[model samples]
Target chain A: MTPDIIYSGAGMVVFAMGLYGVIASAHILRKLVAINIMGIGVFMLLIATAHHDTLIDPVPHAMVLTGIVVAVAGTALCLWLAVVIRGLEHDAASHPSQ
Target chain B: MSPMLFVDGLLASGAIALALLSLNAREVFTSIVLFVCLGLLATLIWARLGAWDVAIAEAAIGAGLTGALLLAARHRLREPTSRDDTPAARRPHVS
Candidate 1:
């Protein structure tokens, strides 16, 4: 079998696993990890699709680069929100008598 | 299949396994660590697929920065309270 086929199949499996995790997990952090896994699968699929003429497609490469940056930004924001929620929980816990 | 194809298949499988492990982990910190490993494996897959630029970006942003953010957030969430314990106290329409 071709490398492309093998790689794409693996990527699909990863994507499916991530999907299941995201659907099953209730924790925000776990969901974030699952989402990032799915992102990696999509990136791998894009790279695999770009393999042509024994070379890679620059367009998808560029797009994946953009996606990496955007993913990081989004992750940071989500993490920040998680922190805020945790802080709120902490404050509420500490001042339960108030 | 070529040797390069074999290598690519290995890297892809490794990436998939790591990703699945990251999601399957019940401990939040362990999941974050696995996510970082998954990102690094993905970078290797990107390089194998001949997307050097993407590989670098995945290593830097997806793995490095994202891991940092997750770690920091995990630290901030140091309270031992269970998430389900205080749903009634939350704001009604913050979504």
Candidate 2:
């Protein structure tokens, strides 16, 4: 098999694993990580498929770059929300209203 | 098989393994560490695929920056009690 095929297959596996992670994890942080993994897997598949057409394609590379930035921003926002929720949880636990 | 294909196989498997391990990890910290490693291996995969630009971006922003963000979040989640223990608790500042 060719390298593209191998990498693409791996990408599919990663995508599946990421999906499973997102489903299994209860914590918001872990879910965010899984979402990022799923994004990377999609990028990997895109690049690999693009490679099959040519050794390298500038378009897919550009897309991956854009995707990375989006992933980071999304993760940051999610993290902020997680911290907020945790703070709320702590407050509720410490100060119970009768 | 060519050396390149062998390397590709190795990187792909390593990436996949790390991804799986990270997701399966019970501790969020361990999962985050493994995820960082997976991101680095993914950078290598991009390089091997001849996408040097993506490789660089993955290494810097993907693995490096994202890892920092995750660690910071983890730290925030783990240390909620520290404020209660320290002298900072004495000062009743407006929330």
- For candidate 2, the TM-score of chain A alone relative to the native chain A: 0.86
Docking quality category of candidate 2 according to DockQ thresholds? medium
lDDT of 2 at B73: 80
Residues A1-98 of candidate 1: C-alpha lDDT, one tens digit per residue:
36667777887888899899889999888888888888888877777788876566799888888888898889888888887777777778888986
- For model 1, the superposed segments whose C-alpha errors exceed 4 Å read A92-98, B80-95
Report the interface RMSD that candidate 2 achieves against the true structure, in angstroms.
Answer: 1.7
lDDT of 1 by residue, B12-83 (tens): 778877886788786888999989888888878777777888888888888887887887666556546525
Q: Report every candidate's CA lDDT.
A: 0.78, 0.85
* Candidate 2 chain A, run of 10 with poorest lDDT: A49-58
DockQ of each candidate relative to the true complex: 0.47, 0.60
If scored against the real structure, what TM-score would every candidate get?
0.84, 0.88
